[model samples]
Target chain A: MQSIDHHFLDDYACRNALRGIDTRIKLILGLGAILIAISADTPYAPLFIAIILSIVTVFCAEIPARLYLTLLLIPASFALMSVIVILFLTGGGVPILTIPLPWLTFTATDVAALNAFLILSRAIGGTCGLLFIALTTPMIELFSILRSLRLPDEFIDLAMLLYRSIFVIIGEAVAIYNAQVMRNGYSSFRKGIIAISMLSSSLFIRAWDRGEELMTAMDLRCYDGKFEILEPKASLTIYHILPVFLFLSLAGILAFLPLPFPPL
Target chain B: MHIMEGFLPSPWWQIWVVLSAPFVIMGFYALRRMVRENREALPLLAVAGAFVFVLSSLKLPSVTGSCSHPTGTGLGSVLFGPFIASVLALIVLVYQALFLAHGGISTLGANIFSMGIAGPVVAYAIFIAGKKVGINEIVTIFFAAACANIVTYVVTSFQLALAFPAEVGGFMASFMTFGAIFAITQIPLAIIEGLVIALVFKYIVQLKPEILIRIGVITQERAERLREGWA
Candidate 1:
């Protein structure tokens, strides 16, 4: 239950100074950074991109540095784990290190090491780009942008309902979990499993019932097939455009650098 | 079973996004049709998506004395079928990526394919097979959920291997290594997920058989038979 609140990042984004920036601009630039990081062959490009993204997210976006680092580390751990596999299982062109295990001899080659480094940098760099957007932009802004793109009404409505229901269902879940704990429902591992199962089923039923009630309420309010909401217009000024342009050019230059790195 | 953000190289990630697009479009069409036909299904589907989000995000104590999260897609697939489950899973993945930083936008296509498409397809297949075989309902639910969870990881391993194959032994070798590493954590977690889903299914069977019947999970006659058997 405690971890549930930790997952809500949009609230943080809304409080940041960058909240006023155009969501569309952030979307384009953020996605551009991700693409550049992924397309870059050398580790230098991604590493540089990651550094720039981190700096912008922390300083310009005003997201706490500690929180930003923690976010980066989440993907970094996964990248490291897979990178380790790539380093050890891959072998060729003069072994850099060799270790004899009980079952198999593990060897790390120069080529594999470079490959692992490339993957690690790219993954981390891509993650940073995503984090920058996520920490600066709210979900409502993204949905509005999606609406402007003329996505189908039903899809947008469903997304809106689903987004609202997340918090409601999580609240219900916490209440149910608390009641279960009071009854010592999770005293043992087996009991914990059973308790969780019961909690989930209960949540399903409650959600279903709430959905029914919601439908009835909407019908009473003369609900049609579409759920309508006003979209906020984001002002695109030079101030907003300049930073994105500068960031992209820097990223592009880093990506096109003539570094002696293995090709992907 | 998610491929962390930007884990895949450019071509591989883009390819997955392209591959997943058709399924998403099909799912959207199905959802629109269902909503148009039965207006009541709109809210139900929304709640189902939210349930998936919350259920998967819950941190539960595992048998290993550590904590793990459930995929929750299998149960959704059982109730709503694969297409709608794909939509729900995609939404959940997007939310996790943006909000929790648990996954990445660049990897959304890969995550959706693995968790949404592959997992639900496997779960639905198993559910249909179980119904055909007249297997015990609880056992069927267990297998469906567990198998779906494992298949997601299996597909993810294949994806990673394809992207970063070993220098010497190639794709199969890399696949085996990634698969084995994931299995250490994923296999047991999948089993636990199965048990949890089965228990939830049992609870629903007892309390709201009509919901299952409405969703075509079981016919009214089958529900009656299940009730009688339990009684």
Candidate 2:
């Protein structure tokens, strides 16, 4: 709701390169990697991918690695929580690694170790890869890619509307939430609950009204189902294709390569 | 619970990614139309998404502070239809994961499909059903929120179960078990969510009567109540 954050969401960096790359290709490459990373047996692969992606994001996409790393805590904490449980629940196989923690025991089998390692790495790696792609790419272009890929007409149309309306509702939510923060001092535990509960109630109304206002406006516009105007897609360029291909190929080769034991 | 990275089997998330292909296309097409029709509304959607995002930052009364983020699908579905809300939920889950590392990018498809799509749709469907049953607005909202919460947890549990294997009931058992553990928090949270939805609806209905008429989002009971207030 702050003016600065609102401005940040609307930003589309790497505009020139972004425009040049076919939206469809990026979707395929980006989404495909997501699939690959999620399915892999070990997190090492995604970690490998993440390393490569961090490089690409910095060098090719020109996004700051620090900015990206800062966002990582959210996923890292989640992975840690799950992995810790898995390490405990999944123990009793061959003990690959053993660690003693304060009031917590961590003894695991090879499978669990592999599972823990893979899940952690893949989740973290796959996520970073996505962030790299999403930040570098624009939402509209991503939408166009959806169109080119033959998404359902109804589905795409709905996204456009929701995407448009979210900000309006957020303004209201922020206003209401901020008001709660002011009243309740959103820091403490007890007050936070009341604030959150109130925010929930308030956000629903605002989002609804916002949606209705949008619908009315559209109704006035001689609303047909068609989205008449669109950002034109750039023609295919070998320059673009070559990079995506190289990236995928490199990831694949890394997957196949045999790394030495204690893969440092 | 937002399943973190390196947790669920990649095969499951991969299958979900495959399923998302069609939705991604549809989502983009929707984006274009939405841009043409409803550009002004996006900041609100972003804000709502951010609001939920910020809620995670707040750390409410859950035993696991970080694990229990609020589900906006019911609110989103009630306000913006599920189709749009589903995408918003998907975006929230993805960005939360990517930006905050809250959830995994791989599981995002499944996460969105379940919590995002299933929860909102279930809530909307139940709300509509409650209307037919002549339920009051407050109760209707509560019922819908409860159902959405339960459905979201149930679906996520099943998805998680598929990642593991059980001898007999398999995912069905996992679904119920996870539901049991989390239901305590979810129960009150769902109620809170419902009350929130109801109040917001009440406020907005007061502000813009035209919107309810156009989107047909409001209930007859609530509309009648608003009319009584005016009288």
Error of 1 at B78 (Å): 1.2
Expressed as tens digits, the lDDT of each residue in A47-118 for candidate 2 is 767777677666776665576566666456545644554554454457776778998545667766666676
Per-residue CA lDDT of model 2 for B1-231, tens digit only, reads 566654567467767667755654565555556656855445445445554544433334554343455576676676666666666677667555533445666667777767777788898898888778877655777778767877887776667667754333555654554555556566666655555555545555665555565556664566778668667
- Runs of candidate 2 exceeding 4 Å displacement: A1-25, A42-44, A96-107, A183-223, A229-240, A256-264, B1-10, B14-64, B76-105, B121-135, B166-191, B202-231
CAPRI grade, predicted model 1: medium
Question: For model 1, how does the per-residue alpha-carbon lDDT over A176-209 read when each residue is reduced to its tens digit?
Answer: 9889999999889899899998999999999999
Worst 10 residues of 2 chain A by lDDT: A1-10
Error of 1 at B161 (Å): 0.6
> How high is the DockQ of candidate 1?
0.75
Look at candidate 2 and tell me the lDDT of residue B178.
52
For each candidate, how many residue pairs have backbone atoms clashing (under 3 Å)? 0, 46
In candidate 2, position B156 carries an lDDT of 68
